[model samples]
Target: MALASPTVAQAQSGTAAQCQTSGANSVPELHKEWILVGWDKPVAGQSWDFREKLGKYYDWEANDVVLYDDMSPDFQIARSPEEYRALWESSFQALRRAHHLVLNGPEVIAGDKLSTSTLEFAARLEPPESQPIISVRARSTLVWRCTSDGWRIVREHNSTRRITPEESRQLFGF
Candidate 1:
């Protein structure tokens, strides 16, 4: 498929009518769903397409993300939508380069979206036949800018920390 260009979502409406008034103010479940769609697994060269998919769920224009308060240093405090796409591509490439052995999903986490669901899932990496798949959640405390197409992840304090089986037991009580 083609990559997501600056104009791909030009024809789509940036704001949904009803969504403009109510949904405009806060994050919605649809936003989460859109993320799931784009993030189920790392897409090779299809990053822009995924971003377009996410745009469908929002009534805002996705520009770039910027950060205010950050507790992580591995990522930048701000990012453009295009920048976010590039970051994803970088990590996905890393996984491939490492020949990582990954597991499939439900990819369940221990919490809900209520601030409790603070896990940022990216892509997991593991040794073949390992006891458990390492979980990597990509997260950013940056801001999302609304673009003509939809909500774009602009800023990021992205992190991909590995979770060991022992840690998983501690976090999930499994």
Candidate 2:
């Protein structure tokens, strides 16, 4: 009997993504997932993929993740796993439906078991036919920690500036 070869995802040279580590632990999978879900177009099974990974990555007991989203008027604090999951799901539902999303210029710093990253990204939303296009260029900061399971976000904050009509024309080719 011939043995089956391990798939690339399993036999790859390194982890899914890379982050600055002072010669220590790396949370590549978590990093990659973050980028993909942030910018890439929605893909089949992505919602479930995020659900499973997030459940494993977040520290439910500590529940330290605080999300300050530009779209929300109040800060969202998750004190438990369920709360975190719900918040994430709600956010993902909206993001996953975006017409276009792009992540750019991400910089990350890693320490003994903690890391911080910041990036600028853009998202465009176009409603049904004969509607206007809305876009935003936002800056986001994320703080992550390495737990026994893996790396998990402890804090996140995002702010955005709306793109003017001219800028929108250039951006969306309207």
| The candidate that achieves the highest TM-score relative to the unseen native structure | 2
- Please give the lDDT score at residue 130 for candidate 1: 32
Query: TM-scores for all candidates?
Result: 0.42, 0.60
Model 1 score (lDDT): 0.37
Q: Candidate 1 residues 49-167, lDDT tens each?
A: 43554334322333433432232235544344444444454443333211122222212222111111122434443323433455543453323334344343333344456667665
**What are the runs in model 1 whose C-alpha is more than 4 Å off?**
1-26, 42-64, 67-74, 93-123, 126-133, 136-161, 167-174
Q: Worst 10-residue stretch by lDDT in candidate 2?
A: 11-20
Give one digit per residue, the lDDT tens place, for model 2 in 33-141: 5544533444423443345645554556564656566654365665555665665555444443453344554577766467777776666654333555567878877
Model 2 CA deviation exceeding 4 Å by range: 1-32, 38-57, 73-96, 99-103, 127-132, 165-174
By summed lDDT, which 10 consecutive residues of candidate 1 come out lowest? Answer: 108-117
- Against the reference, the lDDT scores of all candidates come to 0.37, 0.57
